[model samples]
Target: MGNAGRNAVVLVVTKVADATADLVIEQLNARRIPIVRLDPGDFPTSVAVNAYLGNHGLSGSLRTPSRIADLRGIRSVYWRRPSPYSVADDMRPQDAHWCADQARYGLGGLLGALPDAHYVNHPWRNRDAEHKPAQLAVAARCGLDVPPTLVTNDAERARWFARECGPVVYKPVRNTDYHGDDSRALTVWVEEVAPSEIDTEVGRTAHLFQQRVDKVADIRLTAVGDQLFAVRIDGAPGLDWRRDYDALSYTLIETPPEVAKAVRAYLDAFGLVFGAFDFGLDRHGRWWMYECNPNGQWAWFPDPITERITAALADRLQSPGNAHAR
Candidate 1:
């Protein structure tokens, strides 16, 4: 383990108890690669940063109780999910706000600028790819079949669009979990809708409506670097399979050649090396693109798929160039 390059560390920025990250870190440990696990939420108290511009280049180090990472020596970063920054509650409101701002722009900016570091999916790219409209447009351009979609805030427009598209479905433009006034978490599910069902309230905010595909099964294609895992999800029947996770089953499958090509092109368009794509396999055997999650979760998947993904990510992190596998 000592022979592993100390100058090249894989910086994993995710919160504690992230099972997926924990698995990947363990794999890296087995490979004897240096890793620095960080949770940005612990910035002031547990995480320390000392970054600056020097003669050689951007120079600094991040120090935690367990490990220290030289900013310049960071070979890659697994920018996994992390909690938001925080400040002490005892501080005055204004001072707390000011300190949080400094931490965000100061520490966040420097970390974001790590020299020659490879990001699983760069933060900026992840933000850009998260937009559904952008994703659909790019998928269509890549020769992928996307359902007729409309995003609008006008009730009349939505009604007319639904009428033209036939059996259309409404989905949240963003997957945001809400809480009801009763202090209970609320989840929105995709549901088929008719033109008459769209009310005037649709004009209040933007909504996404797409023609529902007559899908026989759902496919989740998780792309890690150059490796693509195609899993056919069955058992649950409805507008949204996600609503009934316990009822779902998974099977490892291969993506059609054309779909595989388009997946690569779609990722290339967004400058992303990782993306979780959803496709509906129509009864006619055609796959229709639903959406892509740039930072989507895939660890819940069972067995060999999880192990394969962990190995792929660890291999990518260990590679010096931080370039895409393919």
Candidate 2:
């Protein structure tokens, strides 16, 4: 709390057990910067927010166990993943549903409108950038190479596109919570799809099919403010490197000039200050755009790289003026 009386506070919005947020918080703590970390989902239970609109605008105080954050005095906000708002299960289902919606729009709206506080990535922008179709379109427009892709709910169209694209892969446009019959969590991994394998079941919902690149490796480039950290991930024996963490190797690498420029443009197009971009490095040394995760995780990488990213984020949170606001 050194000089905290003179310094503006940073509000970290995330769940209690977030390792990524923990890293940044540790860095800020070492700097003696004041931070109020709270999950909005804890409202009415462990957290409280009081806001009022007056002559100046919306201003209030958010109270947690050990700290209280002044809405107007917050210099920056690190909006990470927060748990969903919940109420007691003993209440009627209909009443609980209504209460949850109210809390979402009420407390959620207040957090989204923190009056001049810099957001690592504003939640609204994150929502807009999360769509895979929009991401591919923007990346291509920014001069980045994009594979031939098709999103369809028609069985014939899917098969036709798959045949035309030669080697195609099927992946979920966005990962959503899914559970098996036993109530265990399930993941839909990216896999090669043959035209014949696709059937009327594909028509049940929209599916994304992309021309699979003859990739030799994968690149995960994390951007913080104006800084970019590119890491080459090798030895992943499957289409998605995320499927196996222990089998992968990481090497810090320099970003290609063209790819770097296009990435910056893509970020600007979506008004995002931070993004984690995934690219496929083909045998020809070409980088193909996969997707850009606005609120993606980055703290899992090896030593020096993770340290650098954490420091950059801490720096951005400390100096809100250095971040661009849409």
Candidate 3:
């Protein structure tokens, strides 16, 4: 291994400003691995990413000119966040945006393009990975069940379709932002639609609608390469399975061979090494695919799930002098 890849080993790029991310940093650091936590603002204007790591982890000198020096010896990276390029008050909106965008795009591109270091989930690959239509198409190709969905802007057209489907679902097309402190971001809402309910706002942004399946239970699938883990969750009236974690039940379910294969294929198709996926288990015990987050959160899951994920990541990074592979 080269000096960058050897003495100063694994680097984890995370939103270091958040408490949740801080807690995660403690855990990863406790694992006895050298970790570097970087906030997006830490980068210089018109900078290259030179993340210098010494004995003290991230506090080491970061020299950014030429930028290539900072990207050295990175065996692997975990794209954990709070996004670094958050809009702030000190700088003018336009000025801040120009710098933040440059740093965000440039840094991600530099590290992602590293000839040897492996990124846990490449940022470029994560792009277009969350489009519901794309996810649906990939799932279908894997032979998984998906509810009929429509992406429409015409209120009349959406109303007509919702009326036909009755209890359809409304989900954010991509990721949603939460402003409140200690926020919860899952906003999956189910409502029985009537034609009168449609509004002009639906046209402003494309409406993504799906038929609400009569879910017997829900499944959370976490995938790391070919390794797969699944947990069953029960959803009742009023609360979605995500928010009702307290009342819900969880069981380690052995994923069917085909289900595992499909999930693996879906990840590979998107060029992702880790994903958190959702599945609706119907009364017939059939699985309906929902979505897969290319850089999803999984720390809240049970120990076995956590163990499998952390081990898979560590294995890939330290794989017997293995060069960074897909």
RMSD of each: 2.3, 2.0, 5.6
TM-score of 2: 0.96
Best by TM-score: 2
Greater-lDDT candidate between 1 and 3: 1
Q: How do the residues 187-281 of candidate 2 rate in per-residue lDDT, one tens digit apiece?
A: 99999999999999988888999999999999999998778999999999989999989999999999989988999999999999899999999
Q: How would the candidate models be sorted by TM-score, starting from the highest? A: 2, 1, 3
TM-scores vs. true structure, each candidate: 0.94, 0.96, 0.81
Of candidates 2 and 1, the better by TM-score: 2
lDDT of the structure predicted as candidate 1: 0.87
Clashes of 1: 0
The lDDT, on a scale of 0 to 1, for candidate 2 is: 0.90
**TM-score (C-alpha) between model 3 and the true structure:** 0.81
Ranking by lDDT: 2, 1, 3
lDDT of each: 0.87, 0.90, 0.67
Highest lDDT model number: 2
Candidate 3 Cα misplacement greater than 4 A, ranges: 1-5, 17-31, 45-70, 86-90, 178-192, 320-324
lDDT of 3 by residue, 94-202 (tens): 8988877876676655655554567677777777687778999998997778888888888888888788885777776765764556675645454445567778888
Greater lDDT among 1 and 2 belongs to 2
* Distance from true location, Cα of 45 in model 2, Å: 1.1
Q: Which digits, one per residue and each the tens of the lDDT, describe model 1 over residues 125-209?
A: 8888999999999999998999999999999999999989879999999988799999899988899999999999998888999
